[model samples]
Target: MKIITLIRGTIRELAAKATLYVLAGISTLMLLAAALAVGADSTPDGKTITFFGKQASPPVTNEMLADLAGKLEAGFAGGLFLGIVVFGVFGTAGVIPDALEKGTVDLYLSKPIARWQLLLGKYFGSVAVIFLNIIYFIGGLWLIVGLKVGVWNGRFLLSALLLTYVFASLYSVVTFFGVLSRNMAIAIIAGILYLLLVAGPLDSRQAGLYLISENGIYRGILDGLFYIFPQIPAMESGAMHIIAGEHAEAAPYAQSFLSSGGILALSAWILHKKDF
Candidate 1:
C-alpha cells in the first residue's frame, strides 16, 4: 500500500510536467500517421510508397516491405532511445530531490512507509512511466508495421524489453544523482555527463588508451572506469540483436542488470542514512 501510494504520487507528478505531455502528443501524432498509412490500399500489388494515403511511385514486394519494416523499427529505436535519455532524464530526474525538499521531506518521513520502500517505490514508478511511454510508441509502430506489411515481426515487440532495460539502467544513474545532490540542475547535468563519458567514446576508446598510455596509474584508472560503469554498448548490441532476430548472449544483459541493481542499492542506502 505504501509503495502503491508512492507510485501514484510519482506518476501524478510526471503527468503534471509539460514535457511529458509534449512528448506524448508527438508520439500520438506519429501513431496517427502510421495508422492512416496502414489501411490505405494504395496499390493491390503492395508496391507503391504511401504516406497518409498519398501514393508514390516504386512498386515494393513483400520482401521489400519486410525489410522496410525492419529498417523502420531500427530507426524508431534510435530516435526513441535519444528521446528516452533526453526527455526521460529531464522529466523525472527531480522526483527524488523534490520529495526530499524541506517541507516535502518532513511529510514523507511522517508517513508510515519505510525509507527504503519509499525510495524503491519512487524508483520503480519513474521506470513505470518510461515503460508505458515506450509501450505506446512501440506498440503503435508494431501494429502499423504488421498491418501494412502483412508480416508481424515478433522481434519488434521483444525489442521493447531490451530498450526498457536500457532506459531503466540510465535512470538509476539519474536517481542516484538526484538523491545525492537534491538539486535538479546538478542531477540533470550529471546524468548527461554520465552518458557522454560512459556510453559515448570513453567506453570504446578505452582499448586504444590502454595501448598508448605508458603510465601504469593512468592505465589502471582507465581500466577501473571501464569496469565500473555499466556496459551500455553491450546492452545496445543486445537491442540490435532483438531487432535483427538474432540470438543475443546473456552476458551483456546480465552485466547491465547487476550494475543497475548495484546503483539502486547504493541509492537506497544513501537515502536511508540521509537526513532532511
Candidate 2:
C-alpha cells in the first residue's frame, strides 16, 4: 500500500509539469525545422546539403535533410544538450542533494517507509519528469523528419527511447551520489569530478596530463581506467542508423539493462547500510 501510494503520488507530481517539461524538445525541433526551411546544411562542408557531387548542386530533399538533422540531434542535442543540460543540470544534480540537504528525508522516512524505498521513490519521481521530456522530444523529431523526407523511421523512435533510458540510468547513478553527500553543491562537484575521472580523456591538453601519454604503457593504463564507465556511444549506434532511415543492429538494450541495473543495485547497496 505504501509503495503504491508513493509511486502514484510521485508520478502525479511529475505528470503535472509534463507539458512544460516537454517544451525543450518542442523548441529544439522547431528551430531545426526553420533551419531546414532556410537551407541549414548549405555550409562549406556540403555534407548536410548534398548534391551527389554533381554540377548546379541538386535541390535539397527532406529525406537527406532529415538524415542530417537526426544525426546531429542524436549526438549533440540528445546527448549533450538534453542529457547533460536538462537531466544533469536541472533534474538529477539539482534534486537529489537538495532533498537531502533540506532534510526532506525526515518527512519521507517518517512514513513507515524503508530508507531504500524512500530513495527508490525519489529516484522514480524525478526520473518520470525527465523521461517524458526526452522520449517525446526525440519521438516527435523522428515523426517530423519522416514526414518531411517521406521515409519511415520507426527504428529511430526505438533508438531514441533506448538512448534516453541510458541517460536516465546515468542520472540515477549520479543522483545516488548526491544522496550520499547530502550537500547539494558538494554532491554536484563530486559528480563532476568523479565523471571526469571515469569518462573524460585521460590524455588531454591540460591538467589531466597524468592521464595522458604517448607511450604504449600509457595507452594501456588509460584503457584500463576508462573501461569501468559504461560506453554511452555504443548504445547510440541505433540512432545513428535511424538518421540513415535504416536500423542498425546493436546491443543497446542489453547494455541499458546492465547499466541501469547496476545503478539500482549500487543505490540500494549504499542506502541500505548508510545512516540517514
Candidate 3:
C-alpha cells in the first residue's frame, strides 16, 4: 500500500467529523477580545475601561506588541494545553481497540507490507488530522493578534510552528499507548495524565527555568517529574519565551525550530519500531 494513500485516507476519514465547533468558538472569543483591546481599548463603545497607567489612546509600538503577544501566548498555550489535557481523554479514545476489536488491525497486518510501514502509515494519518487542526488554531490566534495590533509578529508565525510540533509530541505518546492496548479510552487517558500530571512537574526541576513566581514546591515537583514523560516538547517553553521577547538577546527562533524537528524525528522513530 502506498504510504501517502493510507495516510490521506485516514485523515479524510477524520476530517469528515465535525471538530470545528470548538475551534469556531475559541476563535470568536479571542477575536472579539483582541479587537476590543486593539481598536477600542477593551470598552466596546462609550465605556471607560482602565488601562493601568496608560492613557485612553495609548501609542502603538513594538514594545506594546511584545507585551500583548506575551500575554496572548501565555493564555493561548495555557488554555490550549488545558483543553488537550482534558478533552484528549476522548480524542482518539476508540482508535486502537475498536479497530483491532473489529478485526481491522488484522486485515492491515495481513497485508504484504512491513510492520514499520503499517505502524508509520497509521501514525502519520492520525498526525495529519492533528496538524491541520492545530494550524487552523494558530490561524485564529494570528487573526486576533493582527487585528488588535494592526501588525503581526514574526514570532506568532514561529510559535505556530512550535505549537503544532508540541501537539504532535503529545499525541504521538498517546498513539503509542493506543497501539499497546489497541484501546482508545486507555490511550487517551495515558496521554492526558502524562501531559498534565507528569510533563509539567518533570521539567521544572533542579535545572528548570527557575524564577521567583513559581516557588520551590512547584519547582521541586516540576524537576522530579521532567523525564517521566519523554514526549514533553521543549518547544512549549521555547514558544512562550519567544512571544515574551525573552529570546531577543539570543538566537532567533533557533531553539524552537530545532526542537520541532527533534520531536518529529523522535515520534517517527517511535512509530517505526512500534509493533502495531
Candidate 4:
C-alpha cells in the first residue's frame, strides 16, 4: 500500500507538469503526419509529386510498400525511443529528490516501509509514466501504419517494449543522481550527458576509434566502457530488426537487462546507505 501510494504520487506530480503535455502533443502530431504522408507514398496514378511536379520515379509495388513501411516504422520507433529517454529525464528527474526533501523524507521514513521499497517504488513509478506514454504514442503509430500501408506487421509493436526498457535503464541513472545530488537540475543534466555520450559516439565514432587504435591499454579501456554502459543504438537496432521482420540477436536484450539491473541495484544500495 505504501508503494502504491508512492507510485500514485509520482504519477500525479508528473501529470501536473506541462513538460509531459508538450512532449505528448508534439510526438502525436509528428507520428500522425508521418502516417498520412506514408499513406500517400504511392498513388494510383503511378507517379509521385516532386519539386518538379509528378514524375515517374517508378511504379510502387507491394514489395516496395512493405520495405518502405518497415524502414519508416523502424525510424519512427527509434525517434520515439530517444524522445522518451530525453523527455523522461526532464519529466521525472525530481521525483527522488522531491521525495527526499527534508520534511518529505521524514514523513516517508516514519512509515513502516523499507527504504529500498520506497526507492524502488519511486523508480518503478517513474518508469510506469514513461511506459504508459510510449505505449500510447507508439501503439497509435503502429495502428496508423497498419491502416495506411495495409501491412499488418505485429512485430513493430515490440518496439514499445524495447523503448520502455531503454527508458527504464536510462532513468535508473536519473534516479541514482537524484538521490546522490538531491538536486533536480544535476540529476537531469547527468542523465542527458550520459545519453549524449553513450548513445551517440559509443556506437559509431568510438567503435571506429577502437578499431584503429594500436595501443592495447587504450583499446582495452574503450572496450571495457563499451560493454559496461547500455549500448542503446544496438538495442534500437534490435527494435528495428523486429520492425523489419528480420532475425535479431539476443545480445542487446541481455545487455539492457544487465545494465538496468546493475543501475537499479546501485541506486538501491546508495539510497539504503544514505542518511535522509
- Say what the RMSD of model 4 is: 3.1
User: How far out, in Å, is residue 74 in model 1?
Assistant: 1.2
**lDDT of candidate 2 over 1-276, digit per residue (tens):** 676666566656545544444556555765476335422334453434322232223445655555655554454444433444334434345555544544676677667888667666667766665556666666666555555434456655666566566566556557667767766566566556544555444323135655455677776676554444544444455555654556655555465556667766787777667666
Off by over 4 Å in 3: 19-25, 28-62, 207-228, 231-234, 248-276
On lDDT, the stronger of 1 and 3 is 1
Q: Is candidate 3 or candidate 4 better by TM-score?
A: 4
lDDT of 2: 0.55
Q: Rate the local accuracy (lDDT) of all candidates.
A: 0.79, 0.55, 0.56, 0.77
Rank candidates by lDDT, best first: 1, 4, 3, 2
- Give the local distance difference test score of model 4: 0.77
Q: Clashes per prediction?
A: 1, 1, 10, 0
Candidate 2 stretches greater than 4 Å from native:
1-4, 11-88, 101-103, 193-197, 202-221, 241-256
Candidate 1 or 4, higher TM-score?
A: 4
Q: Give all candidate RMSDs, comma-separated.
A: 3.1, 6.1, 6.6, 3.1
Which scores greater on TM-score, model 1 or model 2?
1
1-276 in candidate 4: lDDT tens per residue? Answer: 888888888888888888888778878898767655655345684423221233324556676666666777787887887678678778889889998899999998898988888888898888888888888787888788777657666777777787788778788778888888889999999988887876557766555776777898987777677677777777777788888777888886788678778877888888889886
- After superposition, the stretches of candidate 1 with alpha carbons farther than 4 Å from their true spots are 33-64, 206-221
lDDT of candidate 1 over 1-276, digit per residue (tens): 889889988898898889877777878887887777653243666665466666643567766766656666777777788888888888888888998899998998898888888888888888888888888898888888777756678788888878888888888888889989999888889888888866665566656666776888987787677666676666776787677666778876787788889998999899999877
